[model samples]
Target: MTETLLILGAGQAGAQAVLSLRQQGFAGRLMLIGGEPFLPYQRPPLSKAFLSGALPRERLLIKPENFYRQADVECILDIPAVSLDTAERRLTLADDRQLPFDQLLLATGGRPRQLQCPGADHPRLHYLRTLGDVERLREHFLPGARLIVIGAGYIGLEVAAVAVKHGLKVQVLEAAPRVLARVTGAEVSDFFARVHAEAGVEIHCDTGVVGIDGGADTARVHTAAGDVMEADVVLAGIGLLPNVELAEAAGVACENGILVDDLARSSVPGILAAGDCSNHPSAIYGRRLRLESVQNAIEQAKTAAATMAGKHRPYTQVPWFWSDQYDLKLQTAGILQGHDRALVRGDPRSRSFAVFYLHENRLLAVDAINRPAEFIAARTLIPAGGRLDPARLTDESVAPQQFA
Candidate 1:
């Protein structure tokens, strides 16, 4: 008798696990399932190059169709899993087909958080989470079009930047006091707000959306201040809600996300979770984290594959993320929260600099804007608890590696 492994949600993590399992010499009956019809694809570019018409649809695929065939992996696409029975180790699909597995991996990821206000269901309102969403939204990215963007997070700002490049009149409405407020420090947020403003992008911080009303041709956005703004299309980039209903329904432990150990094992036996759907303990940060980045999905899936392969590698690598806007590349390493002091290494006015976060002389993280060297150095220094003189850190004369 041969063992069988079933992977749920054919996204970044699922695709990576399939490759890693083969590399680990798993030699089992491998199967991948996804709700989307397309093969597992790269999502980061959907809002950047793909939306800008720079990258084609074929380039978005993680692996070509032949790869799955040659690897002898069965891919079940376009159908969603309906239920999970942990006791019997069976998964029921939407078509009423039930499959049994020896081990299961949940990489169900997440979906865009939708607007709950009235008229949010308007046909012109859009949310960018899937490739189909981008394709539909791209049709309305015309020149001189009035676009209203809700939320000032990464997805919101990235879409706004792309919209501006396409000659669209873009207006970003963020309920928070500043753009990127929830993710970065005050100085970083202010810097981004200034950048967007200088690029002809109208930004409204501290403004909230109340409701939406529209006709067949256009839509009207009602703000909390009783101001009504009309737009050809509206996009909401609020945030994401994890896809944990199947796991929750199966009696799996879940908080902010599915609670998992460093090995990617959930509370239930013979089952594991990864990517945006799972919350695992991070020894480096001394806390649990639910990260929604490409790096996290790839690396953590490798860990989960290793565990399933009877390996002993723990998922303790330092977390890093990056964002591309206009001509700027913002790279971050480690968690910036709980820092006592933040130091700027280069001049922000020059549009190139790095901010270092420290707690009691220990390096916590680094936010590097157009500074690749500083970003690379922080990746190693942060995890090693590297210490540096505050005065020297602020001086650009010293190189980042010198601090290490």
Candidate 2:
């Protein structure tokens, strides 16, 4: 008999798991379940082109309906898996139906964190995470309207770029000293700080909204620094909290997220975790990380599916991420933590440059700003553990080909 695979979330990770299983020649019965009522879709663009009216909802889908039917993948949409019975290897749905599985993958994903201040729950205040939320938020985002975004993180900043393009008044409140303070270095934070400010964005650093005042027609934001900004719409771009309650209640190890091993296996023998809902020990960075990027979901789900299909291999992939801010195309390769030096090979003011984050004596990561050559070169730079000389780095006359 073929094994039964029950995937708990139909987001990027869950959808990739089904695709990976088929690619790896797994002859299993696959059943994917999600709370959303649509087919699996790519989420990164939701905060970017989707909200900006550059892309339609149909283009966001990762796969077409015909692909699922041809793959024989059973999909249950608009239904959430409620409870898990570890001992019985079954899951109870909201309608009281039991789903029996030989193996299960938890890709429950995550939800956006909301502010709890006064008037936070007002109708004007919104948080964007799903396609439905994006559709709703886009309605209130009229051109030339005032938009107050709380948080200077990735989503918030991306939305600011769109609001600016539409000629909307944009004010972003960040509690940290710099934007993306914990993720990247001081240089990166400073770079974006300047980028947004130059684009007519009112970015308030070292400040946070203490209370929200939703007036009869406008929403007013009262900051901790005693600054008040009125807005026609409010967007909460705070971080995300993983949907680990189901895993934690089922006795799965839960840390910052569902604690998974190298193979994406949780504490439960038959249970596995992947994507935003997982905090896996990254062999590349030597620490546990929960990445909400499309790269992590696809790569980690592929590793998880391979392991579930009887293949034994450690999940290790070069960690990379990117963000699109206006005409700036930022491509990053490798994990850049614990870097002692940052070498700028190109010019930031020219808007075409690359910043190399070197750790100790080895190359850690490269943040290329519209420089595809440096970005591609650094992919091999970190994997080979190559040494980069700071003197040759800044000299644009010396090509990056020498490092190869």
Error of 2 at 349 (Å): 0.9
lDDT of each: 0.92, 0.87
Give the Cα-based TM-score of candidate 1 against the true structure.
0.98
Which lDDT tens digits does candidate 2 get at residues 7-112?
8999999999999988889877999999999889988888898888899888999999998898999999998988999999999888888999999999999999
Query: How would you encode candidate 1's per-residue C-alpha lDDT over 1-404 as one tens digit per residue?
Result: 88899999999999999999999999989999999999999999988999999999999999999999988889999999999999999999999999899999999999999999999898899999999999999999999999999999998899999999999999999999999987888878989999999999999988999999989669899999898999999999999999999999999999989999999999999899999999999988899999999999999999999998889779998889989889999998988899999898888888999998899988888889999999998888888886778887888888888885
Positional deviation of residue 93's Cα in model 1 after best superposition, in angstroms? 0.5
TM values, all candidates: 0.98, 0.96
Candidate 1 C-alpha RMSD relative to the actual structure: 0.9
The per-residue C-alpha lDDT of model 2 at residue 341 equals 90
Which candidate has the top score in lDDT?
A: 1
